[model samples]
Target: MAAVEIAPTVNPVTKAKKPSFQIEWASSSSEVKEAQRLRYKVFAEEMGANLSQNAEGLDIDEFDAYCDHLLIRDQDTLKVVGTYRVLPPHKAQEIGRLYSDAEFDLSRLDHLRPKLVELGRSCVHQDYRSGAVIMALWSGLAQYMQKNGYEIMLGCASIPMADGGHFAASLYNSLNSDQMAPTEFHAFPRLPLPLDKLNGGLEVDAPPLIKGYLKLGAKICSSPAWDPDFNTADLLTMLRLSDINPRYAKHFLGL
Candidate 1:
């Protein structure tokens, strides 16, 4: 596939021009390595997770060889700002692992036969945590998903808090996904959330990103799971193509 090119645009209200960022599927081995370097920088160096090196300051595993790497680059400086890895269900099945499977039991969904895409290792550079960087990444993913015939997107939405389990329960209490939650999925057997705690009393002030997913019709799948690398508990979430609201499709996908 050809690399995606994005052009810079000016903000109507501020009358200021913002640098454009392009998102594309990594086209070469070197590009993939660069993407991995970015991931290592974010997941390991910045976030304090362990990493194995391949002599180029990149953290990579067998899973990366088979997955598609989506990279976002600033138009002017050509610096990579954000990235996300997409793994198809067939590849995941062959490897006997789904990114979220480490936390959630995915066996029950076997009968559904949906073409699933696992999105993970999502990150944005600290300096470019603006809306444009994120929008570019999603736009690129949408284009790739449209091309690949993917029907569902699933992943672990990791929270970066030391006491993430407690926060996750509180999150679920307010944005309940009980109807679509996986019956057999959970993080740990012990430390089960008290019934009273699970009661719908989530704080009115939850994280914006989590709330955005709920608004996009994503369903939380069971309890959150502990993510050692991220030092947090993460909730599994899924977005079926059909479940995505039309307004979002029009706004994001330009459909």
Candidate 2:
């Protein structure tokens, strides 16, 4: 996309242009830094995830160099309000693994590596948590996939463990067989959530991002992994391009 200003995302309900924001790929190191700064703000400062303290206040890791940064900015202020990092298959191979590989044994997904793209560190600024920002992110993602011919989207979707994981345990316990990936695609968590120790019968609603993934045909790959640093239960999520919901196909993929 060459740092191009993409088409204004339309509000599905209102059919009005969201002129307050612009979405684009990070074409420069400074642009990527902006996205990283937002990640630090959301993950470290707001959510209190145990990220290493940095002088520049950026959330960074070894994988950042191998991934492409996607940014959604406030047009008025030019602040990156929403961000997602994408690891293409080639880059993942160069990096030797997808980030999810650290948390889960993804041996079963070996056959699909050539077709997989990893999405991670997804976050929207607290003030922009309204529906539109997320939708705009999706629009940018779908366009990326459509142009690149990627087949699968993979990532770890986190569930807060504020209640010591009862909600995550219950949510995993509540999935139907159909909502789970086939056994051949199942990933085993290295540090699994202690489902047996938690109350798994609580009625819990999935976080909005997770619910949206499920609606768009993402499947749970296996049991949740307990991410101590993030203080959340991480579900390895897989979404096949072929399985995208028809309703979202048009809005996201422009099919």
CA lDDT of each candidate?
A: 0.72, 0.90
Top TM-score model: 2
> Could you give candidate 1's per-residue lDDT for residues 1-255 as a string of tens digits?
777766567567776564577777888899888789898888788877767755777878778987999999987788888998988878887887776656666666664434888888888887888777777787787787788888888887776654535566666566644435556533332223343544334464556555666677777775656566567557677777777778789866667
lDDT of model 1 at residue 70? 94
Measure candidate 2: CA RMSD. 2.6
Report the lDDT tens digits of candidate 2 across residue range 46-116: 88899998899999999999998889988788889999999999999998999999999999999999998
TM-score of each: 0.83, 0.94
* Poorest 10 consecutive residues by lDDT, candidate 1: 186-195
Clash count per candidate: 0, 0
**Candidate topping lDDT:** 2
All models, RMSD in angstroms: 3.7, 2.6
- How far off is residue 64 in model 1, in Å? 0.7
Give the C-alpha lDDT of model 2. 0.90
Colliding residue pairs in candidate 1 = none
